[model samples]
Target chain A: MKTQTSRRTLLKKGLGSAAAAIFLRAKTARSHNIKRYPNSCGVLVDMTRCIGCRSCEAACNAEQKLPSPALPFDDRSLFAQGRHGSKRRTDENHFTVINRYDPPEIDHPLFRKIQCNHCQEPACLSSCFVNAYTKTPEGAVIYNPDVCVGCRTCMIACPFYIPAFRYSSALHPQIVKCQFCYETRLKNNLLPACVEACPQEALLFGKREKLIKIARHRIRNDRDRYVDHIYGEYEAGGTSWLYLSSVEFDQVGFDTTIPHEPILNSVKNFLAMVPMVLTIWPPLFAGFHLLAARRARAEKTRQENNREKADEDV
Target chain B: MKMFNPENVHLPVSGSKKNDGSPWSFQDKVLLGLTPRQYLSQLCRNRVNWLLVLIFGVGIPLIVQRYFYGLAAVTHGSNDYPWGLFLGFGLFGMVPLSASGFLLGTTVTLFGRKDFHPIERLALLNGLLGYFFAVVYLLVDLGMPWRLAYPMFVSLGPAAVLFLVAWHVATYLSVQIAELLPALFEWLNRPAWKHYIAKISLGLTIAGIILSTLHQGALGALFTYAPTKIHPLWLSTDFQWIHFLCSAVFGGLSMVIISSFLISRYASWRCGKEFSSTLHDITLGLGKGASYAVFTYLVIKIVAIAHDNEWEYLLTAWGGYFLLEIAIGVVIPLILFARGVRRGSVTTVRWAAAIAVIGIIWNRLNVAIYCFNYQLYQEVPHWKEVWLTVTLYALYFIVYRFIVYRLPIVFTWNKQSRKP
Candidate 1:
């Protein structure tokens, strides 16, 4: 009797697991396709044209209404003020920073300005548990302070290390980052403050598709002057802001080791397990409990029946 | 309590009646049948209480300063290293140690391992307090602690890994509380409540197993987002979740062994004969379980390195440090637990459990802080931040002790108390 019951249960368990596998496969197929907007705007930064002028920095401060800098934006001494032998980063007060990186192989120092990359599939948007981050159709990654729980998972998720928290204000702390001037300028189809204020004509703003074409054309036209690679073209699933550099990107403080795929790709394997475990574990373990209890009961009943037969024989 | 023992002085308030056959009141149970003055003296007698007082004395003011002045006042407030000791040592470190609740729950309730019934309540209580305190640590670390509910009610990013973590931890906490309600009911002499919990115990255990498996994995999956930041040797997106879940199995069981060992040694006066007599065998059983888990964990760690082709990293200095962590945290504990269980040496197992507990915390800290941002400079936590972390754990200790003192967690409840 026990052997028959065990065989039936084994069959049931096998069928149940097969059904779960089918369900899981169907669920995962719909989740991996990330949508892309066709008409997103982007910025093309020509690093060779930049002459380390701080006009864009000044313009960003004024446009964003940020606090006045400790040293005037014109002060060249700020270049030497990198803490821990590292470049200055975006913070609560500043939306962007231009760091001076001197390659040993080059005659002149190159200035690399960085802010939010606003990836095609933004890690910040995907990682925010409260929906605090959004990748706008305009190719801007924006944050809603009202909905943010300030868990700082976005900070961890960002490959560019762009988001900055307002650690100073306990009452109204928020994540401060570049939103591509979306509210004040992007919606009006005007150039971002930094791009408009560039004295070098180093910053070019256009449709992301057009910008990519323009970047390729410039690289092809001046093959000796510029590196063959277009930074951010496919990096982290292709950021909105692209860079053209004279030297290797790693020499100019760019993290050359970043994966070409989106950050969400790495986490998908774990997320796929969530639904599978939730659906399968309860029934699986509950079945085990029932089976164990049944076995226990069967053993007790057989012993009792054997003892009664022994007494009858006596 | 030992200092003022008098003949005919009935203590611990185990049953409904006193030594003189008088009924025990609520006050008697709360005070362990001691006078108000005696209770205060007993509290002051314990040296551990003094250390807790000292921690809170400094930590409470620092906590108040953090709230008024912001995170910058307490933490280094590094934009690069957003998480510090608060999260590194609190959330990641504590959560894995708390996995005991579901592991033991499944063993006793689902698998019908009736021998494990003696230590089941202690495991459940350990999990409940560990999780509860982890939330406390999170509240302190969050930028807008008030908006904690926003993820659940105000806004939802259901696709995120953290979304799974948030939902699973919340539900698992409730499930754990329900699973342990029988002990609470037994202590309160509420037979009806206990009986009700008995009906749903199986369901709660299954829920616990499911929730533990996911969230334990989700915590590791959180680090996958920072693949570029963390050192490659420590981060394996393919097996990160499995690494976390498997380690948690030994971490939780080891915690139970450590806790039971401590209870049997230091708090033996409060324990019943059943708990005291069988604790050695139970420790061996738990140690055997932990040894198996640790062995599996060791294999997976090696497999993770091989899968990611990170063997070259072992030749570097960072690789050396990683190897040291595995040696001290995983390998040593594995060997000790294996030998101790085989030999039935409870002392060896106890030492192994202590080391394993620290090893798991070390692994979490390595992932969350030490090995994070491998290219950037390291950020050491502020003194205030470290103090606050200690303060929260001290408070956790006090609450754990408070519950163990009053409830029938380490000891069986007197079933006859309900008859009167």
Candidate 2:
């Protein structure tokens, strides 16, 4: 019995070690290749310069050929209107919305525009099961409606809660969000419609690296005018869109709790365990099956031998 | 069924032939060896059938309305909450409950526990149906039900956690079907098919373990993708997968116990003497196994909260809610399971199983819906959405009953009919 137990232990150890070696090799060869594109262009939204003009909103609506709004873009009443004490979010009807926030700390109401940040490693792109989302080299996190199975996992994954499903369409429901005008404008090396439409130069489109330098330079020159920290510099592993604000970003509807790392970082541990389970479970369970089967066979043989000996004695 | 099952009654067909020795046709087997009128009469006699009819009568039209008028017409269709009761209750909730298939498979086949043989097929059927209905719920909730196979065939994203979930679930569903095929082959009188499945049953069981481990964990890993969205108490990125996997151990077993207890009470006539006599011992044995799993799950859940340094979150209102969930869902069930198994009280164990089943579903709902977007306002599901979720569950119950009644899941096939 002692010898049999040792043999079983040895077999289990052998299988475990072999599986570990394969798992280790796979782990090294594939250590989460987080694709970071250089020379990607981005938008720098300096909120101090914006006059709360609805020009960008109207420009986006016309540029995207979206349905006209119930109240015209010039209407200021939309700012006061909200659902569940929440400000207007990007939905299928609207790609980008500039919300007016009246913080008590400051005397004036600060107008903040909300849209997709288009992260360096976009959560939507990472979480999409069909590879429907794409973070192009040009800094746009575009979505392919053709390939989308519409599982809505992307919506759950987005830290900023930007992606909204077009629930009205029974046949062709798809996620609607700001794409930086990737197909019509960014692909042609032109500024996005919203940036081009900003009459006060509040929205600036340039190479992401250059934009970061310019944003830093502006903060260094005028410390009192803008917050020292750039909103998207490292949020969610650095979005393509950066923000300079007068007050703390959270006071004006920003999600301050977003981690500095990419959303994929949260899931990487489980993803790492996947290969190990796929590699090890089969051999481990099979070894158990073999041991149990062998023990059962041995018990049967021993019972038969004892019965035969008793019969001879009789 | 009880009213219909007389001592000399020829209904509730257990074998391929009548007592007079004429072979029952396929139709007769489906009707349980009763005439069409008798079958309809028996169905109408049961009050449960009337309840089922009422649910489906309202539910089927709502389901059709959902597809025709779009999700916005039925559900709140809020952009903030992309998933509602359907995925929360149906997919996440049902998948864990379905884990009984692999757990029992590993026990009876891998560990060679022949005493559990009587309940193995029933567990497998439960697992299979739970998973099958989860997909049905997916089909209903998904925006594009037509493209369900795209993840499998058209395109692939191997790096995503959901990709792993999709592939493993699809593969595991087939593995479960193959594992349960022997019972179907026995009912169909195809000895050849049964023999072939038996030869490869070990491989299939091993495959079941591999797929079940990855996907069950993957379901929890799905929440990890939204670390900031879900409350800290519910979301521990490092331990989320293990939390899901560990809890499923008891969740699946508890579901089996609940189903088995219900069957013993309501459908005793369907159970053979062997199944009926051994059921009490089997319940005790299963209760013991479930208690150990619940103990492990409770420990890990505490360990997760500690590892994430989330004790501070417990002091808030959310913390109070979290503690309530732990006490009612985890602690109460664990204590009941332990006490029940120790005292040899099957009734107490059954009660524990029932609470555990509801508790597990409640936990899944909390993680997916209630605690999700913790800072944001809660998104209440529409009444139509709730109706649809309950409707799908009723459909699941019906499918389960239909199969258990017809298949040799609760009872052994008569040996005399094996050759014929």
Candidate 3:
């Protein structure tokens, strides 16, 4: 197992047996279409249209039944608040937040609403050991509190830093994040409360395939008003939510440096070696032991033979 | 310094009779053959004990309060920084240092390097305590400490990196215990049990190597998930596992060297002639291994940089911090170890090893806390949280000292069942 798990020992023996369903489905999906995701859903946010009303935040809090915010949602002063050089981000209490980004080149400050990107290959789902996270066909990244062991690996794995642990809860602590309203809205064919409550018609709900086209259409037609890129089209292997900003995505607090590939791509190199280590290390080390033992026995016999011959000669 | 006349020392073991000819009891063993009053007086004589008492006086209740009032009472538990010192220093820092167990086990048992046999048991004990304490740290850091076993038995997410860590650590902990069982059995005067373990020692050692390799590297791979969160210089996606695994090699060796130095200085009374006399040579030998490992780690770290094409980031402030870590932790130790080994200076090697050990902790801290969320506000550890970590380490110290004092780790056993 030691040698096999090295770069060699990658397979999880227990998991291989227990949860073959997920793997089987993945394989089936791969066989059907090698290039694209099948029937995935998505959302597109138009920053040019956003009024920074905070109605989405208010609606999300009411729908999720989360604790009330420290200040009322109507307070415009929250946009000025920044910490550690960054704007206010999503936390346990607030699943989604709008941060005011002042790009000097642009006349108006951009209001960037940050939440779970709900990637095609969600890092939280991949990194979870208990399989607590699921990427729904409707483009929602849902979390199961029942199976969550609260290791908080998901929080660390997420490229967007979307997930948060309810550390304050001692007895029944679990991960807190936007599930894209998977349970109360998305699953029921209704729009996420945040999307429905957007007063400026900024949040557009549609199939992930169509959202890409819509984002490109807006950028392609209005070249000067919008940046030429869609924020989540390929970032972290494409997310359910696509964004079109007037200025650069980084100017509006988006992590522009995220890789085009999924987060798992980085870890797969090491994981691939685990099986190799497990398979090769045991026999190789055991062979070394056998050779050493043989040599020691040979030396011992040689010394004993010489001693006996000397005694006979004497 | 007065040389210890280790030849006259009698090691602790079962069936050893007392001066009056009566057999030694378990109570006598626990009390170190001294009366309760004498033991108390001896403990009180040390200033260190007083400090430990002060730490425990405050630390113990805080631990209780954490359980009752929850982790929020003791920790910042910040949403930005989910993992604090408990994991960064305790699990990530300590596990690699404990790699000595497998390295030495493979050296003395699998490869049959009889010269390292004297200090091999010490290496094994160091590994055991490091791992055990790491788990203790995990217990304190985990939000729902009771559900720790969920990754193992209840709802196994075998595909998860943490799941692999949980299984491997638990299994390896057992393997290490088995590898050390001969000594434990010998101390208990159970020759039969010792003989039984001796037959399977090779298997246990091999298991240790396998588990140690994957898990040590897996710990680094854990950070691979947080590509954006961790600073690029600290978090290498391509070579993160290799970087972690390679550093652990030196980290583990350096820890063994540090433990040996401490044992020679503070545990002379417990060491046998063979152990005390040969420690200098062993220290040098271990230094050579560590120097090689550190050099490899440095090269690989550079390779990781090149592979990622991260040269541009080098001009930034985070790059300076990364370079400082390499210079102080890796480069200095590598140079010092190389020089110390060549000069055959035990003191030089000892200092080099100490620096290397500190480097391991520094590197882990950089990854888990310092460089983590570099763009966010730093989460300073709560004073109680820091104290609790200190308390757990003290407990680790006490347990380690107790085991070394009683077991045939530092000392040589005269039992018939004992073997290399």
lDDT of 3 by residue, A1-314 (tens): 44545433345665665578788888876753323566777779999898899999999999999999888999999888866656787877999999877799988878888888889888999899888888777778899888787778888888898898877777877899998888888788899999999989999999988888888888889999998999898899889899999998877778888989888878887888899999999999999999999999999999999999999999
User: What lDDT would each prediction earn against the true structure?
Assistant: 0.90, 0.90, 0.85
Please report how far candidate 3 places residue A258 from its true position, in Å.
Answer: 0.4
TM-score between model 1 and native: 0.95
Error of 3 at B362 (Å): 0.6
Model 2 lDDT, full chain set: 0.90
DockQ of each: 0.74, 0.73, 0.54
- Summed backbone clashes in each candidate are 0, 0, 30
Superior candidate under lDDT, 1 versus 3? 1
> Which candidate achieves the best lDDT against the true structure?
1
lDDT of 1 by residue, B1-420 (tens): 555545336666666666666777888788877888888988999899899999999999999999999999999888999888888989999999999999999999998999999999999999999998988999999999999888899999999988888888899989989988887777777767778888888888888999899999999999999999999888999999999999999999999999888877888777888899899999999999999999999999999999989899999999999999999999999999999999999999999999999999999999999999989998888899999999999999889988887888888766553332
TM for every model, in the order presented, reads 0.95, 0.95, 0.92
Model 1: docking quality category: medium
Over B1-420, each residue of candidate 3 has an lDDT whose tens digit, in order, gives 012233213223323454334555777767766658756877888778899999999999999988787778888877778888889889999999999999999989998889999999999999989998999999988778888888887887787788889999999988888888878876776767787788888889998989998999899999999888899899888788888889999999999898888877886777788898888888899999999999999999898899889999888988888899999999999999999999999888889999999999999999999999987777788898889989988999999988987888887655442221
lDDT of 1 by residue, A28-112 (tens): 7655655667888999999999988888889999999999999999898898887777889999988889899889988999999
